[model samples]
Target chain A: MDSSASPLSHPFDNAIRLTGSNGHYQGQTTAPYANMVGPFGGVLAGVMLKAVLQHPQCQGEPVALTVNFLAPVADGDFTVDAKAVRTNRSTQHWYVELSQQGQVALTATAVFATRRETWSAPQTPYPGAPRSESVPAMPKVPGLPGFFANYDLRLVRGGIAPMPQAEARLPHCSDTLLWARDNPPRPLDFPALAALSDIFFPRLFVRRQGPALIGTVSMNIIFHADANTLARQGEQYLLGEARAHRFYNGYFDQSAELWSSDGELLVTTNQVVYYKE
Target chain B: MDSSASPLSHPFDNAIRLTGSNGHYQGQTTAPYANMVGPFGGVLAGVMLKAVLQHPQCQGEPVALTVNFLAPVADGDFTVDAKAVRTNRSTQHWYVELSQQGQVALTATAVFATRRETWSAPQTPYPGAPRSESVPAMPKVPGLPGFFANYDLRLVRGGIAPMPQAEARLPHCSDTLLWARDNPPRPLDFPALAALSDIFFPRLFVRRQGPALIGTVSMNIIFHADANTLARQGEQYLLGEARAHRFYNGYFDQSAELWSSDGELLVTTNQVVYYKE
Candidate 1:
């Protein structure tokens, strides 16, 4: 991989100067570099959610972030800035924005719950489907067109292992399994984990005939349990499956399952995809 | 039933101003209205998409539209203005926005495909599930809860229907149906259809048992066919069922089937719901 030309260093990220480039700091720009294409409207709202969670003012626990796509982000260098609109001991609200070259592309204002260190609580999650331990190690599918390169993937059962053929839809009852991981794993922080929203690809079962004609806009993750447990498990591969999908017009929504190899169904994902096939 | 004090207006129709709000017109204010709370944020983008298609200097062949939510809309009203960014006989690019209100609360800049009207074409939609030929429609569930009174609804499903039982896992087979209608049979025009983006409720199926929940902020719609045909079908009822949902961090993407009363699979709806249920 060429160092300077990698997709990781998007045009937007590089435009951030150390002190300022119209209205941002260099440090702030690199934060979203982790996930280049943001949630929707071409703004880094998806990444912004994570950053909001990591804010210092939150007191309870940051669990969810919902963004309303207000506009199509103009193409060019931009900035994402957030201000704590409201705050207290337990929750905080933030107003954010994406300005392209200087014009606003998308704007988001949200609330975040804080983590309280003094609270003691019982821990358990709904009995989810057993987690599968047979997930093979993740493969390095770098920007290789098939895997989107951000996550390491291992095909356990239903991968279009061969690049071209995985495009066919499996029978309605037949499902596929695959393992995915983020590089340089750390304590599954909200922003980092949310960034992995692009990881799971169970919908490969929804086969398309011609070219690989599919892409995602944004995803919402429900933290059913402590995501921090991901580090202790010492295992990375997560089993995931697309549960349902409906195609109307030129779009389809695919619901999926994300499970830890240890039999723990860790997360459920639902995404709308636009595929030109 | 009380005429003026009624929350009975059709939200989809051109809403009459209760008080002459400056946000409603142009010149002095470029914004549309207090878009954050009103249904306008999502609807504005939809209207812009439609306006783009109807721009002069091009054939008015209907091109589908899909708007992905990026962030929460800003408070205050904004303007949704559209113009042909690029135009030719075959394809045109249209730019639209809900602007000048706390920055663009919503915007859409896209291309509209136009071809010379060809010989009349054959039309075939799925035989939609049956419904009352002329049922007493439910009062429209205008913009989520508070924002009602702007629109009305007539459930073509006839009357108050029972909500389906909750299921941890989706049905094994892929079959879906439902019936819905906008109150006051307003003329079905592009702008009107765009306004329906606010009407499609993919979140109602999973309303929280309590108040601590968020709803769908972004929705994408793909029109498979022409607008005239869809309107000719009369106030269409929406029938949908999901394929699967991945629940992670209080967010999910649901794939669904959308059908009309005559079993005509009207359109498929793919939505990502954000909630804490």
Candidate 2:
């Protein structure tokens, strides 16, 4: 939609870029795109994936991705090393690690596949939710994750109060349904969608009135749509829904889905998080 | 329980063993354990993980594992190379691969964590299906994957007829609820649970009368039980439930859960399968 803005110059592109040689890459964390600790996990996830996508041996579109956060990433320069572990005629597997000062902070794996047309049936029914245009966007506030400002997020249900008002009333449930689209609208693509996958607020905040320290320890996403399907929905809002199934042993499991407005399931993502009081 | 049978001598233990130095190991496929095209995926998955668990630097218990089947394995010896991608105070990440004739066949990554006691809750309701003891064990027959004999499996619903009687009557839905336990009554551990996670018949077979060629392209599993919890159910049957949410474009995704009879959720696994006519 914004032909004058080259994809190469997009903030997402700049933030996830790598520059180095001999199987290593160097990147710098960007501000205004920063989460509470570092760059948004989704963007960091994109960076890890970008390392592979930009690799000489990379092949096929990403169909699955798993990222494990070993520690908090410090804001500043970091390095990523991606290697293709196995490659078949139609599929490939990769391992990626992001590190700072010779210490590994994040580790990830991705699977790419060349898909062919076949019989399709989606059993998960789309939610009976309202349209994006009918809801007001979540207002940006100080002391919140800066990355929130980069997207137009409209909550349809189960939203937490602002940080300043968080103590007033806590949500009764962790389920959340919302409409989200990147600000300055960019075409829907793998990296953008990957970043969007982690954009939901931690389920802990949604369930409890009080705030707690929380971080995603491991996340896995399965992609169901092809590039053409994603590109066709350029600049349009996608429906997102997330809920936690279990909370245990200082960790919990959350499952979320991203779907096109018309009801095409794009991705299903799950994560395990660590929370501390 | 068979006290005279040591776990090291179990068929499952023998099937997942590897011999080698450093991070590289070698293994061979066993007869009566073969799938339609190669060794059963569950066995291969266990073998890959075995390489890591057996590694000298391996630490902690498995918290998450993701295996990508890049290619089909020939029924013979294969090599596996595993590396500790990163290690932290409480967690370790590993990358593993299975190869034959010097080419990559399958690749996987695992995250091991030292879990601590904390608040726990499982929201998924335990199934209302009948107890496993009341159901009949699936009979072993010719033409099915020989690996089915490795475990004692009893189906409660949405089960396909045996190959000989497959044409007699097919299940109407793509859902399966079964009870499964190691034939030799081995103590359940990470590797054993990993293998059991994939013991279900393909959802496609349950929905369609005839079988089509299919293979798991990728799988991700999250472990919710600890060693104490797993061992407490020693050699007991686990309630296994599986269903597919969508099938499209040569690929479909199936989600399965293994729960202890005492109502503890042990693992939640998901995979994308490629099918062809």
Candidate 3:
């Protein structure tokens, strides 16, 4: 597939497609990205960000985004209102919302800023893993959610598959390392990265070695890469490392970092999820 | 030193006090919590949370808060408008803003939830450190910002004090571990925890062994404790571990975890800060 093909040709582009102007946009949930209960949170996040990015007055690239999932988004037409709440000389702040039938389903706040050269270093060491080419992609399992097929995931460790019964008695570790990219090979962009930030399965599944009813209450992503860096990572697999810090009182928090194939840290994301026992 | 003293007597309470009803509030910046050029970001964060906490419609304890610092808050009276955007059976979402002179200075989104008993565990190991009683509190230094005096901080390791010149050639590490609590022994609460989450100095100062022009652009905190747990904590110190993950271009990110004296995880926070060379 040619990278320069029309945006409608890519499933991701079509899923996040928004139309309207001056902060109001109309979008629809696509079946290709549906989750167990609603659309994938990452796609919803991408839709919210797309509303901002498509706005006429938006400045710079996205540096941070906080999305709060308020209610289950029913499949169909939805609207987004992305407002640039404040625009500073260096950074801009945005308030965005996704709604259906005049009811809010999600609310988000984002920070966008232009970058300049400064003292740069990575304090968090990269979790070294085998090259993407060396690892086989996760096989497409039947009966999985439709969204699973949209990503080419190469699990390196701590996958969601259940451990042996003997090993289940041992301490559980909800950590996962994988190399992932959009299927059909779309170039990397801010929206694509936003969606990829949420590609990991819920930590509960990995810890318990099984699935449960879970929903993310709130998710935050801080982008460490600028437009130039993201463009440099076009169509490349991103190494993702994720783990849970604490799962207490019906909630667990997932912290993950995404890096380019060349070991450049691109983004760090965290989300709090609620689960039923 | 009395935890039950009138709220007006405690500087932290006074710093975050809001006067108003419904979703609107009026607050002032107290001198005790002043930062280099304005109020400390933590106190501003507390003020934002307090607005929602004081609202009559608030349903439950805060689970997550994301504060975006758009402009420098001036030292004066400010108004906060907190709206409960959505309220589900288990969670309530809030959109809050702090404004001065009719201009938005800070905006935040928060999630509050009534948690129930469920399967719970901690995946992230606690970083062991010396007991709070063993380490002397950080002494009050002249010329430091007034907010520094509000927290009794005992440094354990990775202190901000510069390394010896002979050791300066070694690789820089910006990690900090400290025991912290409100000075004068205020009891633990959501507002106090929010303030402590921003207590660490910027990573640039720790890495370069000197101060620079820095400002936090956005901060997110996910609370892992319930109201009962916080009440049990009383005035005990919280062990805080903070470090920078990636410092690139003109921004850097800080990730920190706060734990109770009993080794229970309490809160995890992340923020992206802007720095000028």
Candidate 4:
């Protein structure tokens, strides 16, 4: 899929496509979006939202989504069952599950709300990160998650691994500032933003060196921008800031923010990760 | 129902009790826990979690739970259907829905994890809020939600309402700090903490004067302490701090921290709320 391709024909759309019958949908895992264990968590999260949005009974736009990665998903065929459990005049609630080998691998809940004009304010100050041109692009490492090749990441700070073998120091804080845009340069949408929510590396890796058995236990994301805001920023780099507060007893939680280059708060996300050192 | 009663006999237990046969459970709203238009969100959240905990197939302790308030629940008999969508040796995923009159009113997904000893640290420092003994307890105001009597709240700051028509100024920040405990002194546990997650008043009320139609759209809570920690803090007041980062276009989000009286981090919670003026 070329970066210049149309949104309807993008690989991301193809990767998350599902054929539905009787409220159950089926999709196949694509090589480009595979993670070390299975499909990328971000992609999976996006696919779950897609499942909900594509449902015939779906309403409004996504405002909140929570995804629980119960187990590792193997690359192959998968099934998603999304149900709009409740529909209100202004909001809708959905429950979605992804299953492989007839066992559930992921479970998620989402709230979609119809937006209206009202008093508004954003209290989180923009990171004011350096422009994308000021930061060097991350060198793609071989043998990493297959999905790595699908993102173009430029590090502004806290670039720990894949170092040039010099100037390596233990990160003073588990904070990362970067600029990221999907590789085929897809337009900003719920699914794209959902996938981008998990774009940051594990906070452990950001703070310490070396690998560990790490998996995201749960992730919650709230979309702060509307469809117009996202559509206007299509294929452009979005500033991302991520930091962790606690790492304890095999688990740690982190918070992140994604902002449009012009300073719009696109999304706020948080997740808890499990690590075995 | 007495504060000094054993955990088994506490009113919190009675409030969340469900009678089930073959995985479906039925519960009714208790007057003591009714909110403005329905039961308290925290109580509803607790009951949803209770459904999972009481499930015969429940696997481990809860680590994360996300609840979506789909609609305004009416006071009456409601049914909860809890499904163990997936179970591994170490963790289980569950999806639950609370329905009334055959309409879904609330939906939630929870992740329960088996714990193991490992490296541990809490990065967020203790807030060191003033002792409960020093702060004046909130006066029970007439015409408030019936559930207001369920908790004993002591305010250290951000006490905007219930004033005696003096010492009231526009709040400068949407931050609240106080000591809170179950009025009936129920022992600390997952359900109690879940209920406490929504204990704070809407930030809109905290930041501005007057009333507005406010509803919690979605809430996510991550449990930071183990069962032992909660058990040891039994029936003790916990320090709570809540603040918001944004209030935009008919919605706003706030994050909160719950700490034991002695400074142990217990739970971190975040929620997005809907408002109309």
Candidate 5:
């Protein structure tokens, strides 16, 4: 079957569906993408971008997006207001806010530009990994967050299983390498890529080998590939590598790179999360 | 001499100086920190943060800052309007805009939070580097930008000097390791660190072995240290290590980590630049 031509509607599409026009739209949380305390942040990010994409004044494709999670988003309808603050010759700037119950829940800024042919190369080499078919798919645990079921994740290294008592006592390195794609095999798109950028579990959970109170404060994703490049990826798995640089005081920041199966870098993202120990 | 206690004011302070209140202020570009086109982006970022830091309603220290360079900031006076869009219990969200002649020149969003004691560790090992005292300072060339004269830079590797024609034909790696601090030895502060985070030259210059028409479209800086930690680094050189992840089409993105002389990770920054080849 051609995954790109699948007739069934993808859950991702339904979760980010919006109604209304003229820079203001209404959306609601869907169960399939619910997180522990709110809708998955990646989904919210997608919604924010969608707001601008749907705007009549928006120009060019997304080059950079910064999302700030101001407060917990309740499980219900939310409104997104997207304004094109400035539109230049080649690039356009935007400010988007998601509000629930008349309260600001999240805010984001995005840059979109028209691309032209130019000198291009990748400096970061793709990490070696076995073919996706050879790796076992991550099993669906009964109690995991609903959003985990939406993606087919195959771990290459640094899985989040609890560490042995002795290993947990020592300072541990935090890194994750995995092969991932939307489950049920949906075709790759910008919104899906935006959502996938946030798929990595919090570094606190990955390093401590246990649960803790954590929330993402801000996330920035830079898209390197245009529409044509992403379409070429189809439903193929992308290799994702993520690692934390430091965990200090009550905050930690992590960086991740997503690469196409054919070795093209698709996106680079950095995010800071707040944690309580 | 006690550098921290130097009676003379620093150029950074004068560059970011503002007058006014109630989430609105006026500022101007100073000659000392001028770049090729407009003022140095780092100094503008510092000014944006200062607008918020000086706001009476601001709650905590800055944890994340995202600056979007929309258009060239012409020399002269500009207005900065910073609004605390939302102030939560532990974190505050800010929206700042810099405009000249009634046109928006730049827009930035920042998150500030009240930090508390928590488990802390550094996962990414610091790169080896010679002591700041052991390396000779970078000499000021006649044609360099004015901003270059304000910082004492000691290159450990990956200087931007042109390569031989034969070597330039092949693809080259882009990375820079250097030690840098204010030239006049001013004490460290949040705004100063914000300005320092953008000290790395465009990766295009380092990789292509020559100059290109390039400008930073967006930059994000995440602070890992607080005021107390910055105070401890007064007038001290920071080891800056930066590298490009990928250069695609007309745009490229790079990531950088700024570490203190004692090997503590002080800041992590990422940016996307537009290039005309």
Candidate 6:
């Protein structure tokens, strides 16, 4: 009578259920890992930051968690919430939700990390520019429909077209070339590789038509530990790249680099893009 | 004092200074001219949606805007503010801010397009795949360190490297044989050709340090107004690509593309990254 070991397998060992604990409101974990489609955007962002650190109660623990998928939760059973209006004592504030049939796909508001962790290093190095040496490669070009086709491309320099204009000025934010990799290999597990590097988007080649943009409302991340040092660069591939990208009025910004193709270096991300092509 | 009569001066007339009224936020601006980061991110997003359509007195007229830059103002001078928290009737909610010496570089929140512009055709088509056919040229690679040479890259296929125990499976995002024009061309405008196509950032490359990773916070864009119909398909090299790059547990996402040179299609973007390498 295991009832086929139901409850969607494990649902986070089924626990953290407190209805209206104190502050951050709405809570319902129940799936450690199952149904997939529905409650997994970082497990509905760890049940909205563990129901906003057990609500209003404040404290500086959960460093960060930001989400904004908006919709796409169809696997089965779910309900993860958060609502801490605001707090201080070091700092704490929450406003997250992740419902299911009842709608509300994704919405977030988290700003934790009142400090502490003391990693050190921001003596200021990322000011701007440096990473393009003749640049030109990027061309394997495949994945269309449901993407993720074992990747592994390279093209060290501008490949096709009458394309040939910018050959001098390289400051305002320029120079770029890449050589990616990720075919089959998995298990690097940094929150499932940061949920697949948050879906990769160097501003999808600029688009705009009479103006109408939407799809990402917020995002923020900052972590360190040398980001794994690319496991000593020898995994065949993992190296990612990008240095600068800035779009004004319509809003958009970028800065990237994540390597490991015998080069090591494994994590660094920054993004702030909002429609304007 | 015309500064040589202008080699492209006006970093914002000399850093805005308006006041009080703002006179209904003016009009007939040719959509802030070609737009893509010029009229100073749309004059601080039209003074934050004209202070939320003149404060809820509820009327409606904006269609889109969603910005966030954290820092990097200094085009010449600074200071721009906007406000209008929320609105009803049709929909309104604005908030714009950009500062320089004062601090807070950038931050925005907009939701315009209250419908009315009617113009259809995008039921979603332009989705093709399998185009390796020839793959050869891609060796320009010489950008990075101040504007990255203004873009003109090349990287055709992932140049093998699976040594360490045959490591292979890297392709979750990266394929850019880019070709962003207007290096010295001149006179295209539209926020300097959208700050030169939103400043290339195909995930970025070369930083190495073991597990390599850098920064990018949040970004989301979806523009496609025939963006000049692929610039008349005169085919000037464009082909930018991406898909499947969702680094969970930590934060990151991907989906990008911009093609030309016979391939047509001209703009696209999608991002979410939170570094750690």
Highest TM-score model number:
3
- DockQ comparisons of all candidates to the true complex: 0.08, 0.53, 0.84, 0.66, 0.82, 0.02
Evaluated at residue A106, the lDDT of candidate 3 is 98
- Model 3 chain B is weakest, by summed lDDT over 10 consecutive residues, at B161-170
lDDT winner: 3
Q: What is the lDDT of residue A104 in candidate 6?
A: 64
lDDT, candidate 1, A26-81, per-residue tens: 12333223332433221254445534544554444434333323334433344566
What TM-score does chain A of each model score against the native chain A? Answer: 0.63, 0.92, 0.94, 0.93, 0.93, 0.28
The deviation in Å at residue A172 for candidate 5 is 0.7
DockQ of 1: 0.08
* Chain B, candidate 6: TM-score: 0.27
lDDT of 5 at B233: 91
Instruction: Assign candidate 4 its CAPRI class.
Output: medium
Q: Sorted on TM-score, highest at the top, how do the candidates line up?
A: 3, 5, 4, 2, 1, 6
Task: Report lDDT (CA) for all predictions.
Answer: 0.42, 0.80, 0.89, 0.83, 0.88, 0.39
Q: In order, what fnat does every candidate score?
A: 0.02, 0.56, 0.86, 0.67, 0.88, 0.00
Docking class of 1: incorrect
Per-residue lDDT tens digits for candidate 6, residues B204-272, read 331111222433333333333222443464324455554323343333344454555555434444444
Model 1 ranges off by over 4 Å: A1-132, A137-143, A146-150, A161-176, A200-206, A213-236, A243-277, B1-11, B16-130, B134-177, B187-229, B240-257, B262-277
What is the per-residue lDDT of model 2 for residues A90-119, given as tens digits with 9 covering 90 to 100? 888888889999988888888888888876
What's the distance in Å from true for residue A34, model 3? 0.9
lDDT of 6 at B53: 45
Q: Clashing residue pairs in candidate 3, if any? A: none
Identify the runs in model 5 with alpha carbons over 4 angstroms from their true place.
Answer: A1-8, A162-171, B1-8, B162-171
Ranking by lDDT: 3, 5, 4, 2, 1, 6
